[model samples]
Target chain A: MAERALEIRSESHTYPIYIAAGLRHQTADILKGLGKSTFSAVLIVTDETVGPLYAEEVAASFADEQPLYICTLAAGEQSKSMETYYELMTFALNCHLDRNSVIVALGGGVVGDAAGFAAATYMRGIDYVQMPTTLLAHDSSVGGKTGINHPLGKNLIGAFHPPAAVIYDTETLYTLPEKEWRSGLAEVIKHGWIQDPELLKVIKDQWLDLSAVPVDVLNDTIRQSIQVKAEIVQLDEREAGIRAFLNFGHTLGHAIEAEAGYGTLTHGEAVAIGMDFAMKLSGKVLGSSLDSEAYNEEMIRLGYDLTIPASCEPETLLAHMKRDKKAAEQKVRFVLLQEAGVPLVRPVEDDTILDLLKEEMTI
Target chain B: MAERALEIRSESHTYPIYIAAGLRHQTADILKGLGKSTFSAVLIVTDETVGPLYAEEVAASFADEQPLYICTLAAGEQSKSMETYYELMTFALNCHLDRNSVIVALGGGVVGDAAGFAAATYMRGIDYVQMPTTLLAHDSSVGGKTGINHPLGKNLIGAFHPPAAVIYDTETLYTLPEKEWRSGLAEVIKHGWIQDPELLKVIKDQWLDLSAVPVDVLNDTIRQSIQVKAEIVQLDEREAGIRAFLNFGHTLGHAIEAEAGYGTLTHGEAVAIGMDFAMKLSGKVLGSSLDSEAYNEEMIRLGYDLTIPASCEPETLLAHMKRDKKAAEQKVRFVLLQEAGVPLVRPVEDDTILDLLKEEMTI
Candidate 1:
């Protein structure tokens, strides 16, 4: 098969999200072309786990003339705190990194969020590259949604700072645990449900997939997923309008994650459960044609642990979701599916939501 | 005399800078019109001294239903620190301020810079009203150049955050110290030097006895000053190209300010001294036709302490100017006048600059 290089172009910026099997080895050549020589130093921001795995290989790629610094944080959702953000910024400042310097974010969503935000605010922003090492990063890394979590809200304190480039090395995915892969797939599934019905069919067909998928097919899927996010973001840079549609399952998912205390549930895992709950509610209340049996079978085949454990009470989850920044005046605003590829948001009443929870509890 | 309002309009935004005797009383009505608010809470951000003096009067004019909260900082350049920024933002977050929240910056340039930057970053930015109480703010407050000082540089970290409304109450200028009045006149002189040769004659004629000028004339002068500034800003939102003309005296002024430590030499005083030096250099090397003696006599008559003291050596000032972000590499760039109203930038050789300084010192 011929190797295909895909390009994602926007009105203000255009860069390629290179997705290939062994792209990590060619990082030096790729980055040298992207204006890295102007900088005197390069700082690598990674997680505790990922730092040991790929930090050495990535560090060696930078030219021997430029000094390098590696900053690593704990590997969890808790790492996206203000304390961590301040520490990372202090690290960069102490290193005497100037405006010409760049930060390399090399981890999952948490690392990307914190590091990207650090880059955004450090010296009023600087160039940073997204070296996404997780499946969820395929969404977070490409969209420039870099921010730290606020006590009042998740991803509340952030700016629309686009990355200089995104290098998605698929080889890194081999080290991800099954739970992490399942988490990443939830977002991929979300992109399909919101914008592309064909994506849903493809995923549904590959529900019980063998590990025999070609690199080109995986690359195409990542590109299409990115296009869905990029097109929405381009229309609404600040999430004032159309971009809010991207919060399909996140309205409930975030509430559950916050209530469960962040690290207790992986983002994708919570999102997977939220998508199921949203789909069920859609079928009962919003007249969605999604078949419950087919949906459950596909989720099971994809290895989602969708059991709503008794510890997370439906009332508590509902309350947290209502307190979501997206909610106005303590009302849960659900971005429901009118059909595959047709997403709409409306205020859902507490009573109906409670009844929906009661109906889903039987599962 | 009819109280004429000085209307200053920029692209995407418009507001009035009312300069008249006893116009502080007119704040309520003007704010209502500019804000389009019949009833909304106003977040008044002022310094420790300014808040006690005018926060009450400003708050009293609003409708009884309109709530007001004061966010106050110390009244100096030191208050523009990151700690004050965090405290002010935390106050707003605790106050339950929303997107509709209006921030009223009710102090001088330092207060405006700090408060305006706080407003710019809070909730990714909120609308602000500039009720400038100092003459220096006539220039800083109008141009939308809101930022705080870093230890390494002045105004290095900031964004182009234009205020929603600017109410320049000239009545407040009456309380300004004579030194401050001289300080602000430096910027007023700068605007004329950059864009209007006729304005220089106006300044040269009546600047010494500005204390006796009628409030209407003062209003007209301010209007002209703001028009020159607004026209320049309208063309260049960010300091990309032509806007650099605004830095005619700023390069030397900032270096002087930094060398003296920010608060010691009030911004205008340093710029006053810097402008005298620049004009002298312009006449020496660039063949400027303006008689250098006339420049010094006008400034002296206006109560300016134009001498660059022996303590702030020309060598130190030159080094600080070289560290300016505007400087490409280590070379010092100056905005010199080819003729009055025709400002142009060129690199001055270090030897010629040293020669000019040595000559000025001997005089």
Candidate 2:
């Protein structure tokens, strides 16, 4: 019951983002506070791995609740597909969930995206809570970019559907492999780099070994990252203007992900490469000292694989980027870094993009 | 183009409602304003009946600007199904429509509901316009209650997605069969009965002989009905409160439609019977002088079969109504009329409903 809750206030709703070590142990008290006097049915959407660990604990929390349906899918980005989305919707309908029913999403980014999209479309939207068990989910669950991937591109069909609440239990991260932890940290690093230079400095100074990082520090970092995302989402719920800034590392990142095929590489790894390219382009265009060669060295030292794979050529990535929904006409837009706390979206010329790719390949 | 334009102003949007004798002549100009310069694809959704006449017209309107994709479904309530919705989504995707792509609903209420729901979900929603060709669409086009039907009930799966604009070309009514005209007028009659007693009197007087009623008067009546619907929808976007008033005849009417099989009888015809039964119950419970007997006589004179079909037994109709989305706690709630101008949702006891049905059958 280590409890210092992070509060999120949106235009339409206000809820707490509870981040604690082993918060799953207090599920009953949290459900009571959320005003579940009589739970008729609950749907738990999870992945192949996390379901075994926490599904029973959550179901036990609501033992008196009749007919709790637990549905699990295969882990990874490939699961975020139209087929899975359709299956989940049919499951919800078969479960006879009224509007009062709550769907709990428990896994990493893929599970959150697929499950949340299901909740958004099933019966024209319903209440959903994010029980994020992976570090990547700490970002995806909070901001509510929920949707499945289209065959043409990653996240081509989706909606901005905020969850009813987010429960990030830090204890679940203890079982995560080192590579998974690194994969998650890229996003945390991006958040810090984009919004808070102070947080970035703190991570740079304190984070050396992934295993030994204090739970409180990790919780604070996740909460701060979520707060930054939540504030941006509140200002623009539907990504009309400033909200597009959240695509800081996503333009080239998505193309790389789509080219490599989903599940070939973790999302954060692709994003790590995209962020490096964007920073290089940002330095070229904006001449920011923040994007200097030292910044690249720092990123490499922080255990980020910042190279675009030889299998996915820069031209292929460019072709995929053109197919993205954000592209206006034939020109693709990238959200590049102006400085540590400032980002800008601009259309880069094809030759310049090619030159950057060529130069970065030698490194 | 015989110009008649009025603006509909709501909190989220302000658009014009246009009515003209031959407004289809202005389709090109109307679409030019609505079509995005970025999207090169246009999807026109129409019914089998209307497709032959107007699909080419709409296609020609957008000929210079974008590629037109015409999709026609069976011209009835049966078209409002998950299969139809999925097909429409696939059509849009296959057409290579991005976010900027536009959908034009070109038939009646069925087309509007089906197309609007497709737009609401396709690519997580896209822009759409309502080019309503029938009088009943005055209600459906303005309210944004777009949905596909579930096996359990009508509008069981839906989203409240407002269209970009509504273009009502009154001249299309010249091609409508007298039966089709009568079918649409049922909704017009319901709108008048729920909110405007004066409009009801005008219809009753002018519509004594359906052949004698001028098209201008009919158009005005439908437009007024649309205003009433739009005003209520503005107050309650979703059917959370005031909007439920619009479902006055829908509960029992839906049951009758479903029981009879969707294509067997027109929507308005089913609603006309529902109205007769509702008015009779209202007179009994609310002590209103509705003249339910006279109402039945007038409907019969107007060539509407106001009596419930013998095959539609009371218990079966009761079962359908109980399964209706509007029903709560296993009670079939009826929106009863205290007077022509006032409607209230009341829970009618099972015995009371059975008595009213028996009495109405005798009458």
Per-residue alpha-carbon lDDT of candidate 2 for residues A1-363, written as tens digits (9 for 90 to 100): 435467666544666688988777776556556654544568999988999998888777765646788999988767887677767777877788876677888888888888888777666667788888988788888766788776655566665566777888888998898778877877887777678777777677877777568998888888888878878877876676878887878888877877887667778888888888888888887786674566567677777777787788877777777764443455677888788878878888877787888888776
Give the 10-residue window scoring lowest on summed lDDT in candidate 1 chain A: A1-10
Best by TM-score: 2
Cα deviation at B304, candidate 2, in Å, is: 1.0
CA displacement after TM-score superposition, residue A144 of candidate 1 (Å): 3.7
- Stretches off by above 4 angstroms in model 2 are A1-15, A25-40, A63-67, A325-329, B1-12, B31-41, B151-153, B208-213, B324-329
List candidate 1 segments past 4 Å from native: A1-17, A21-43, A59-79, A87-101, A207-214, A324-330, B1-41, B64-67, B206-213, B324-329
**Docking quality level of the chain pair in candidate 2:** acceptable
lDDT of 2 by residue, B1-363 (tens): 334365666544676677766666676577566534645567889999999997887676554656678898998888998778767777778788877788889988889989988887666677788888876677778866787776655665666667877888887876777777777788888888899877777777787766446778867777788877877788887566877778777777888888887767788888998898888788777787887777777678778998777777777787777763433556677888988879998888877887777766666
- Looking at model 1, residue A19 earns an lDDT score of 75
lDDT of 1 by residue, A1-363 (tens): 213355555433666667777676666666666744666678999999999999888888767867789998998878887678767877887777777788889998888888887786666667788888887889998766677766765665555567877888887877877777777778888999889878778777653452334556666677778778878877776676878889888877887777777667778778877888788778767888877677678888877777665567888887777652422556677888888788888778888888877777765
Worst 10 residues of 2 chain B by lDDT: B1-10
Write down the TM-score of model 2's second chain: 0.90
| Reference-based lDDT, residue B354, model 1 | 77
